[model samples]
Target: MKLYIKYMVSLRCKLLVRQELEKLGLHHISIELGMVEIKEEITEEQKQGLKSNLAASGLELLDDKKSILVDKIKSVIIEMIHYAEEIPKGNYSDYISEKLGYNYIYLSNLFSEVKGITIQHFIIKHKIEKAKELILYDELNLTEISYRLHYSSVAHLSNQFKKITGHSPSFYKKLGKKRKDTLENL
Candidate 1:
């Protein structure tokens, strides 16, 4: 049985889910962000127990198809931003559509309807969060960060950063505050 889970966006989440499954004595085939597959059919009691355990850890098992699709979209974006070494070449909408096997408009509309935020805004928010992380690491300058994130220029990055964060990249860096949202929350 394949279970789609919400808020399973990080390594810790995967571990937590694995632990819960083990505690329930359920054998899982695989555990991935936002989804898991179990080898054996589970009893209703086991399913309820698993759901309760997951909920205690701030995760929810999704049954609705739309909700599952939305979670899939989120997992893909989070993976691209936080794990992928190199940004894929091409427009994000095209990439997302191709990856999800759906039209970009349909995905965008579903995302907006479900999340109350546009997909573009979600990407921009995550990008800004990533920018903050890069700035704090002190590994790359603003120019390098911009180039790495596919921004047109440092000015463009700064402008977007300022718009979203209410602080310019330089100022935010100087502030030295590492205020970051969890991946699931974002």
Candidate 2:
């Protein structure tokens, strides 16, 4: 059976889920952002146990379909932003639509209604977060990071970064403080 988990947006969460499954004697197929697949269906007591364990760690075992869909959207956006090496080609809406098998307009509207933020804004936030990571790593210069992330130009990237962060990318890089995304935001 597949399990949809809220707040399973981080690697640590995945590890926790994996450990829980092992403790429960469950066989897992795969564990990805906001999702888990196990070979066997869980019993009621097992469900309760898992739910309690997950809840204690600020995660939820989602049962409702709509909630699952919302978490799926969150997971995909997180994957695209945090794991994808380069920005996808074509329009983001089209890419997300194709990825989720939902119409872009409907998904965008639902996301905004449920999350209280526009999909565009979410994408921008993720982009900025990714930019921060790139800058901190110092593996690539601003121009290269911009190009890799499909930003129009270094100036545009810096402008967006500064707009969101209230500090220039160079300043942030020099400060070397951690830039992190909230779990809900990711």
Per residue, candidate 1 scores C-alpha lDDT tens digits across 74-149 of 9888888777897776899998999899999999999999999999999888889999989999899999999988
1-186 in candidate 2: lDDT tens per residue? 899999998999999999898988999999999999999999999999999999999999999887888888888888988887666878999988999999989998888888899888888898899888888888999999898888899999999999999999999987774343333356
Query: What clash count does candidate 1 reach?
Result: 0
Off by over 4 Å in 1: 177-186
Model 1 — which ten-residue stretch has the worst lDDT? 177-186
Cα deviation at 144, candidate 2, in Å, is: 0.7
Q: Global lDDT of each model?
A: 0.91, 0.89
TM-score of each: 0.91, 0.90
Q: Indicate which candidate wins on lDDT.
A: 1
Clashing pairs in 2: none
Clashes found in each candidate (C-alpha, N, C closer than 3 A): 0, 0
